[model samples]
Target: MKTLYIVRHAKSSWKYSGINDIDRPLKKRGIKDAHLMSKVLNKMVDKPDVFISSSANRALHTAVIFCENFGFPHFNLQIKRQLYSFSDGYLVKTVNALDDGFNSAIIFSHDHGINTFVNEFGNRPIAHVTTCGIIGLKFKEKHWKNIRRGETFLVEFPKNHK
Candidate 1:
């Protein structure tokens, strides 16, 4: 069984002027939500074998919070520039390329791509994945490349907890 955790980055700040989308930092509420959600996730599931994140600041920061909550070393977290993409094609390519050695993985990324990927690859139909939200999908296939729609095991959002 292979488990994949897909997380949409926490809310980001638009307060900065002339900052690129990839460079935007998380807002105060984003920090609180990341902490809250990470604690909730920690209690719900075992730590994943690997944690991966988009190189974008917001996504990387959220992944860091999860890593800290699970005591996964920061250096062990993998940052992929290709994951910075906003399209599901890139997301799909990333998942398909995951090393078979790791049975479970977590990916922190942006919205449209994350939402599209989950809806396409997961059995559950989520209208939208809020910031700091987590969607866990389980696949029956042994290889990541062969993974098809298996199960939507967990769905958590900050609003539900709040």
Candidate 2:
């Protein structure tokens, strides 16, 4: 079985006027939500074999929080620039290319892409995946490249917990 965890980046700050979308840092509330969700997941699930994130600032920062909570090495986290794309095509490509050696992986990315990917890949239909939300899927397929629709084992969001 292969487990995949998809996380939408925490809320980002728009306070900075000239910053690019990829450079937008998390707001204070975003930081708090990341911490809370990370800690919560730490208790609920096993640490993933791989952690991947969009090179975007918000996504990377959110991934960092979860890494710390899980006691995973910061250097082990993989950052992919292609994951920054808003299209689910990139997300699908990134996941389909995952190493078969790893049984589980977590990916931190943006909205529309995250939402679209989950709806396509997960058995449960999710209308939306809010900021700091997490969805855990378990695939029966042994290889990532061969994965089809899988079971949604978990769904966690900041609002539901708060």
Candidate 3:
């Protein structure tokens, strides 16, 4: 069976007022939350075979921290620029294009799309997925393209722990 972990990028800082939305860095709270969530998932969730994240600064930073904590190869993570669009349809297309070599994948991106996609593919309803939030779904099928709304195996975020 294929498995997927949908992750919302950690909170971003607006301190750099002139920076574009795509270039905002993480806030201090975001950094801590990312660390905590990474550690938590490292212990509880199965390792993902692939790691994909939006090329935006905030999401990319979160994915880097997660890869370090999860022991995933740093170079293996793909920074996709299109994921920044935050569109569920685009995200699904991205998933469908994934190679079958990996049975599990970690997809990190922004909200609205992540939130919408999760509610679509996840059995449990979510009002919103907080920064650094992670929801794990277990697909009944073995192929990525055949994946649909499967079982919600885990729903975790930093607030729940701290």
Error of 2 at 55 (Å): 0.4
| Candidate 3 residue spans exceeding 4 A from truth | none
Can you list the residue pairs that collide in candidate 3? none
- List TM-score per model, in order: 0.98, 0.98, 0.97
Clashes of each: 0, 0, 0
lDDT of 3 by residue, 1-162 (tens): 888898899989998878899999999999999999999998997789999999999999999999999999999999899899767887887888889998889999988898888888889999988999999988888788988888888999899999
lDDT of 1: 0.94
Q: Deviation in angstroms for 87 in model 3?
A: 1.9
**Ten residues in sequence with the least summed lDDT for candidate 1:** 85-94
**Ranking of predictions according to lDDT:** 2, 1, 3
lDDT of 1 by residue, 43-150 (tens): 999999999999999999999999999999999999999999888888888888999999999999988998999999998899999999999999999999998887
List candidate 1 stretches off by more than 4 Å.
none
Question: What tens digits encode model 2's per-residue C-alpha lDDT throughout 1-162?
Answer: 999999999999999999899999999999999999999998999999999999999999999999999999999999999999998998889889999999999999999999998999999999999999999999999999999999999999998888
State the lDDT at 59 in candidate 3: 96
